[model samples]
Every structure is written in structure tokens, then in C-alpha cells.
Target: MNTEVPRLSVVVPVFNEQDVLPLFVERIRPVLDELGLTYEVVAVDDGSRDATPVVLGLLRRRWPQLRVVRLRRNSGHQSALAAGLRRARGQYLVSIDVDLQDPPEVIGDMLRLAQREGLDVVHGVRADRSSDSVFKRWTASLYYRLIQRMAGAAIPRHAGDFRLLSRTAVDALVALPEHLPVYRLLVPWLGLPSGEITYTRAPRAAGRSKYPVAKMIRLALDSIVGFSAAPLRVATWLGLIGIGICAVLAGAGVTAHLSGTTVPGWTSLLVALLFLGALQLLCLGLLGEYVARIFTSLQGRPAYVVAFDSATDAEPAEDALCRL
Candidate 1:
């Protein structure tokens, strides 16, 4: 790590954010400059179906320090972030969303904490999130609690991709091989000394949020199952409990029959059958998740394939280095 390099690489993953890019870049550049730090802005185009790429090209034309990386297909947010991390060339790396809800000015606070506190990672936490609707906020809170319970990680409630990482932390994260790594979970797995800077998340400036409720729910499920075995264990307990319930019911029915108090059993049997069937489906789904992850790992598939490289990076070509 070059401590004196004095360069901060700010990576923003864009997916159809053309309308907001201009404002994001304008607000961010000035804040970056105010930190007295040399920086490069990397905009990862995650196969935007809009005019995002054209707008990114316009920015690159205006500023030499602005760089754009274009992916051939829409790899999800995690993949886009992985690509940006691979291309980042700086002593410190800051990754955030293009929506700008995290605020650009917080970068200075993160940098100060990193340097003064000697922390390897600095995650920005939302001190108060009154801007979000009640349902959204409640779901967000529930998602974090569920992940913490299942993953047993200290991932903060409101932290997203808006964080600063030291050179070592960046390298460590990129070295990880999980195809669907939830960075929110991996940060704690790496066990780096870290601190947080509190800030209020701002509302979207334009172009609706990329993540709707469905996407948010899916992401939350992926994070919990990807990082921990608790889901499978819960499935096991559910299956066992279901069996126990059926056994007790059977015993009760047999006892009633022996006592000559037998009643028509169709309704009771039908209800038990339906309940057990649903339980079986839940268990199967959980098992399938683990099996799928293991099967993919055993198949030795690469996490991502670089369709093309527009910029040179320090590491060897990913194709040359990929062991999986």
C-alpha cells in the first residue's frame, strides 16, 4: 500500500441513472476536491438500457480524471461493484450508489476517521432515517435484524455500499471468491478494525430508485442465506417440529378410537396433510438453496467474466489469475 499516493478512488455503480448523473458528479467532485485529495471518479455502467452510457462519455470528455467502465451485460450490483474494485487505483477506495442518498461530503469524515483512528474500513451509518416511509423503514430494520440473527455479523442497520476501505481491505475483499458475496456480510468476515460516521440519508433527486420492494426483499434473502447456515438449520427444525406434531396427532386419534369416541376423521386428516405439505415445501426450498450454492462452487465456475477491459489494472488479467 502506498501511504503517500494521496489518491482516492470513488467508484459509483450506475444502472440507468442518466438523469441524475450530472447532478451527482457535480455535487461529488467539489466535495472530493475539498478534502485536498487527488481523486478519480469511476462510473461503472452496469449495462444501462438508457442514455446513461452516452452521458458518461460526455463527462469523461469534460474531465480527464473521470473514467467510465462499461460492462457488456447487466451483472447485478455486486458484480458491478466487484468490477470497480478491480479497476480502482488508489490508496483509499470509496464505493457508493449513484442515487447520492448517502451524501458525497461524508467522504471527508470517513477519511479523517480512517487516518486519525487507524481504521481499515469506515462504514457510513444513517443516524436518523426519517426520510423513508414507515413500511420501507420497518422492512429495512427487519432485514438488518434477520441478517444479524442468521449471519451473526455486526453489519449495521442502515449501512449500504457507502463506505471507505483501506488498500488492504480492498485487496482482501477482491480476493474473496464467493460468487454471490453479500459485501454487507463480508466486511465483518474480514475482521478489519472499522468505525462509522453518522449521516442522514437524503431522498432521491431524480429517476426513480433502482431498487423496488421486490428487489430489496430478494437482496435481503440473498444476504442472509449466502453468508450463514442458519436458514438450513431453521429448515431442519421446522421439519422436525412438523413430524412431531403429526406424531402427536396420530397418537391422539388412535387413543380416541380405542375409547370409542371416534369422530369422522376426514377434516382432521385433511388439515394435517395440508400443514405438513407446506412444511415440506419450505424445507425443500431451504435445502435447494444450500445445494445450489454448493453445486455451483463444486462446478468451479468463475464469479464473473470480464467481457472486455477498457482500462489497465495492476493485477494480471482475471482470466490468467482465476483459479476457479
Candidate 2:
């Protein structure tokens, strides 16, 4: 085992990525090897039910620098990334997905930029995502715009979780109290000295995409609700709007009564009731989401539980490295 700290750590979160893991290894190993820097690839296995673990074992036999951190269950992608971040023993840590969409070749550029400019964080921005569906492109743009405005940070557009962070930056992120961190926002929110490298996104080299529409929406919600109180404020504004609407309706009804134009009809009453009901329900739902987050924080449950770490001999204790 390489006991010495590595110069760089490449943290890749894996979840049922059996098909793409080999290809990812093929591409990423060469890029890092050519850099001639002592680096470790910390692959966080997020409880893959497939042959991913077996494949990882096979690859690790060939790649001495490859380290595997297997979680007890299928923790989400972000949690797996967090586990990697905490376990990574490198001067600088770079987090990327196992999917080949985000090119591994750009890691060299990011590392060089960070080293050259003394940047604590280097973001690998997607210069072009023409490979994505039109709906995805449009929604991604909208999500970024909305998040940037709400976060009030100059978050680089098209920048996802693909980024490199210096040791200090990684420490700062790990020290955060957030249990479920939306790193896409939290990283930029740190306001660290940063640089950007643009890369054209390629289609997935293998395996079906893990992020479906539902997960994407959940991520947006987590990002928005985690960073800003904008959603709560939205609920408040909606309540005010509902009040104003009720007042206007009341006035109209009073005027009709005074002018003797008031007709006995259930349609208007039913419509008004339905609208108010929907508005109230929406507000309640939003408030419930916030309350649920509070409950989760109070519970203090770890985001992930490490099952095994190849670097360590014994089976890891529950929540040993995942208590954030």
C-alpha cells in the first residue's frame, strides 16, 4: 500500500455503473498517469447490486493506486461523493462521475490551471452540451439561472459537480454542518479562489443514465431549498396573493349585492373554493418540505455508511467516516 499522501485524488462516485467503470478506468488512468504525479483514484462504490464490485476488484488488482470505498447500501450519488471527499488523502481532490460524459482528459487541464493560477477550486464547466436532449438543455439552463439568482452567487453557468478542490477547500467542505449538501451550490458558495475550464460534454459511453427526470427534479429541490429560503418566501408571497385575491372577490361580491346583480350560482363559489384550496395546499406542502428538512437535520442521521474500505483491513464501523 502507498502509505504516503498522494499529490492528487480523483474521487469518482459509482452506482450500478458496471458497464462504464472499465471504460472510465481506461480513459482516466492514462490521463492521470501521464501527469507524472503520485495520485490515488478513490472510487466510492455506492452499493451497486450489479457486478460492479467484482469489476472493481478486478481493476484494483491491476491499478495499485486504485482504492475502493464501498458503502453499506445504495446511498445517493452526493453522499458517495461526500464519503470520497472525507476519505481522500491528497493535496488536491478532484470529484467526477464515472460516466464518460464529463471527459477525463479535462482533468489535466483543470489540474494545470489550478496549479498555475494558485486556485483553490477549478471548475470543469460544460462548454457545450449538444449531446443532451433539448428538454434537458432548456431545463439545465433554467435551473442554473434560477439557482444563481436565488443563491446570489456568481456560480459559473453549466458547472456541475465536476471540479477540483485543494486540500484546504476539501477540508472546508467536510467541516460544514450540512448533512445533505448540495455541492453544486455549496462549493461556489464558499467563494474560494477559483478557475474554470470548458469542455464539450459527450454522450454516455456505456450504461443507462442514473439520473432520471425525477432525480434531477429532486436535486434541483435539494439545491434550492438547501441554499436559499426562496421557496419558503415563495409560499409567503403566495399567501399574500391569495389574500389579495380573496379581498378582490369579496369586493366584487359586495358590489354585485349592492347593485342587485348578485345571482345565486354555485359555479363561482366552487371555483373560488377550489382555487383557495389549491393555493393553501401548495403553501402547506412547501412548508412541510422545509419542516421535513428540519426534522432530518434534527435526526442527525449520517448521509452514508461505509461498509468497506480497501485501504483499511477491518470492516469499517457504521457511520465511522460518514458522520457529517
Winner by lDDT = 2
TM-score of candidate 1 on Cα atoms, chains taken together: 0.92
Q: List the residue pairs that clash in candidate 1.
A: none
TM-score of each: 0.92, 0.96
Per-residue C-alpha lDDT of model 1 across residues 1-324, encoded as one tens digit per residue = 232344799888899998999999889888987888788877888888998876776776566677777787887888788888888888999999988788999999899999999999999898888888899899989988888878888787788888999999999998887788778779877999999999998888788988898888779878977888898889989988998998999899889999999988598888998999999999899899889888988999655555444354342243233333
Query: What are the runs in model 1 whose C-alpha is more than 4 Å off?
Result: 1-6, 307-310, 313-324
Q: Show pairs that collide, candidate 2.
A: none
Residues 1-324 of candidate 2 have per-residue lDDT tens digits of 558999999999999998999999999999999999999999999999998887888787789999999998997989999999999999999999999999999888898999999999999899999999999999999999999888798889999999999999999999999888989888988989999999999999999999999999999989988888988899899999989999999999999999999999999999999999999999899889889999999998999999888888553443233332
lDDT of 1: 0.83
Stretches of candidate 2 above 4 Å error? 314-324
The count of residue-pair clashes in candidate 2 stands at 0
How far off is model 1, as Cα RMSD?
5.7
How far does residue 269 in candidate 2 sit from its true spot (Å)?
0.7
